[model samples]
Target: MSEADYFKNMKHDRNDPNPFLAIFMDTSIPFDEEAKAIYLRDCSSKTRQFLLPLLRPLARLAIILLQIYKSVVPNALTSSKALHRVLYWGMKTFVSPSANHMILRHFYLGSEVLQFIRDNVPGVDVTMNPLKPTNLEPVKDDLFLIHDLNLYNFIINLNRELRDKGLEVKKRDRLNFGAITSTRIPIEPMPDRWTNFLDLTSAIEIFTPVYQMFLTDNDFWRATNSLQLDETVGLLASKIIGSNDRLALINNKHPMVPLTTLRAGFRLVLHGLATEQLHALLIELKHKQEHADLSWNRG
Candidate 1:
């Protein structure tokens, strides 16, 4: 089946006994061979497994040190050069080329799915404000601070709306972008490699394991589980999306769950903020370079 057709036919049962199986049962979209090989190698590494416990404490120390560093030099973490170097080092040391390829490809595929939903779903507001890279300096830090919470709110709100309307994208008609008129088109186009900056996938892979340490089993399961197309429009939608509601109830003396989930959620929020700052800094630098190149060519 075509990629669009494959996504169209995808389904998930929210009441499934095994959430993991529900999310990954569709193996039609295979992982890249090299990515699979690297994943297997890491999983089988005795040394890596032994060092895994050390990472949790080290990650906490790094966080404390970063806070101190940021206080000492306000712009240290936000500096374009600093951001670029960190991204370079992380990609070179931690991320594999094949993994990067797979990450970018998933992005493109995810975008296609979203576009399909926006086009087909009635009354769905998928429109987002255009990112003003040039005017981002003033609120760049603030943007990073709330990136995770903002994403959480977005997913929750969108899902709630979908539920209220009794609408779903997966249940829609088959996606047919029409027959190709040109024989020159490739069956599958490769995504461009993101060499200059850290993408979301790489950032999540690098940081989430440490963040996972703070979460409860329920919260951890929620964090790790993947969502279907109809679920929050392909984002990691879960029961924990209702955590904010639970928090409000707890504040009103009607506690539904332990306070630890709240603490764990905040840690994830901070992780998202820090990751976004790095991403935004690199993006700002990229835009500046492009502008400079254009000006130089004109001169």
Candidate 2:
């Protein structure tokens, strides 16, 4: 078949033999692969921090307007959207600072945590004495505990969920357990059949060298720079996703990690002193990433 026809056939899943997308699905982790697959599915259901950038300013604006109205006007304004904005702010205020992921209007139970915390962990004890500090030093002026009772309950629920899946903390695979160390809250494992996760993310170390070369590949880089196509290309490179899920994918955008990588979500990285060749290449990569990030799928 011709090259265009070959790529067209690859248009489906990573199961297709296009090396660009195949590596994502072919690799396996030491733990049960199905469990990894379930983890990916749950992660996808929750908005991912690394896939897309959030328009937090807009959310902030909605919240602020609602707050001001609540302060002076009191019960005058009662639109459902306004109620939502006010509720959203309260939820964000109570959420753990470590929650780097996007806070959606959905996720109703998130609000329940605050209520649980306040009901149990009040600012004062039975003697009516103020409690300990609000937050960590420098982060918040006061140290406050969000009522450990709720957190204890959350842990209970989380553990129970894992147990129901036939996974016990005592018997959990070391590989999957270790992955949780890298994240704040441990994400649930995939069931036994889904992900072919591998421990050697290091073997993927070849990625850095390969990315550097791609950074320097001006002609090839130029061909891949269009925002419209870059989305699809990034999805293909990452596996487990494709560009058709536009908004969902963009919200996966994570923070700029200091670690150097070939393609952190499809952006090439080059590491070398400022030689003209590499300097020009870095500039090109930055441009390509910025160009790729725009919502070209929209008008």
Candidate 3:
């Protein structure tokens, strides 16, 4: 058969009746392999000049606006350290600071709550610990956590979103998280599936007093009210789509990530509890996990 005819037949026979031939699907190249190849081909610096005309207007506008902003804003704002703080505050106040990543949001929230407990709750001594990746199956997921691009993409998208909403956002260099680390609370990772409940509780039992302190402290409530984190959680729940569904070939023997990913709903709510120590956080997680209704689906 001709090359074109072979490809046409391949498309049509994707659902071939013969099990042997259909099972060989594993050998086939990815559907987007050609598109990916084309994208990489056009990514060269020489090829990139082809789009100069398309970007000229945007580049000019950005340069003009930047000059105007720099001129009008106070000279104090020009300091790299001050500017970073301003940008970071804007991101936290207006946008979801965790890039709307469900799991990361939990870590962020947990750290904040722990810090609050340490600062305001008398007699409570909550220690901040680094959450290292676990030695679990599918090491790729752990590696994905270590990569910094996710954080960078979140910041870039945040700036884009703010600009779309009429804020004149200047393009800044890749943000350094270390600059803002002092402001962030640290949190340890939760127990993995392999960890027994008794062992898990033992590690986390220190948090019980912290959680109780949150319940009793009026200052804690005041702090949360000031941050308007409840609304932030609502906004995040509405914005981030949360589901744990996937498609797989029935005959495939080896599948990646045997379990569905943590649904956004659970992650967001869990973060709320971890960060805010709101009433009945655990209850909410349990209810949603059991029912997983449309409301929970929003996260």
Candidate 4:
């Protein structure tokens, strides 16, 4: 039931040292940090001005904090008192105390905390689990598993390595990823961000051959539908949550299937919760997950 046991079961044959990337696309480009900071702040202001007129004051704070977070997060992921105006903005806009509190809840704002850990904190482990509910009933054809991961951080250790030598360009990024354990940053390992950054910096292509990187329906569907899955998978998945994405290729009839299933899975391992708290959790999951959806270009 441990993560080590779970990852051990994977059918990994690749000698690819960097994360086994399924790069959707990779053209050589150049990109940096200071430039990143300025881009972040500009984008924040524009978002606030645009969202302000239509939203309540508290909602306005939600938009604004995200901006301040961008400005301050160039260094860490925790809230910055230096830019504490977000609080003032929220209270001013959301007059309903309950509504105002909801808008400023820490989890949404805790994105900064995550960033802080990534930059300043040291030695934190993150776990991800994939335990979304599927048809547990004996319906033969209706049985399909939609597994999503939960990330936990009890034991991952991180240590930074600089100017790593002897790395072929293709392998450089993976080494850095490997070194990420001893550090306290909680950034996810999803290919779109960190891996892409590495590829851009090292001039290595993600999913270079593109064809092999593509996930075949057979590859995903068969894996999902497997009834004999190791039960320890959920625990294993929890260790990798931030590093992986919750995905679905199910029939379009169930657009929200992934989140719904995750709701069920939460009940299985978690229990004895207050009704109000549980209710709130589900609501946030629904709202944030909608924001989490991705768009892809048809090839």
Candidate with best TM-score: 1
Q: Give a tens-digit lDDT track for model 4, residues 39-126.
A: 2232234223454334334333443444444444433433223222332332333222222222222122222222322332223333
Off by over 4 Å in 2: 1-39, 42-54, 76-299
Please report the candidate that would top lDDT against the real structure: 1
My TM-score estimates for the predictions, one after another, are 0.37, 0.18, 0.18, 0.18
lDDT of 2 by residue, 70-177 (tens): 456544533333333433332234322222111111011222222222223213121112222222221121111122223334444544554566542231111111
**Candidate 4 Cα outliers beyond 4 Å, as residue runs:** 1-82, 92-95, 108-299
Question: After best superposition, candidate 2 residue 232: deviation in angstroms?
Answer: 44
Q: Report per-prediction Cα RMSD to one decimal.
A: 16.5, 24.1, 25.0, 25.4
Candidate 1 root-mean-square deviation in Å: 16.5
Q: Per-residue CA lDDT of candidate 1, range 1-299, in tens?
A: 43333333556556754333332343332332233333333333443345445554555555455445444664432443333344344444454443333333333333333333344456666543212221213122332223223334445666676788886644332322211111211123322344423333334344543334322333333443322112233222112121122111111121223232223322432332232222222233335556777999999
Clashes of each: 0, 33, 0, 37
Ranking by lDDT: 1, 3, 2, 4
Candidate 3, 1-299: lDDT as tens digits: 42223233544354555332243233322212221222222222232344434444444444344445434542322332332343233223332212212223333433332332223222323234433222212222322222223323333454454556654322222211221122222322322232212211111122222221222233222222222233332222222212111111112112222211112222223333333322123223334444655666786
Error of 2 at 289 (Å): 51
Candidate 2 vs 3: which has more lDDT: 3
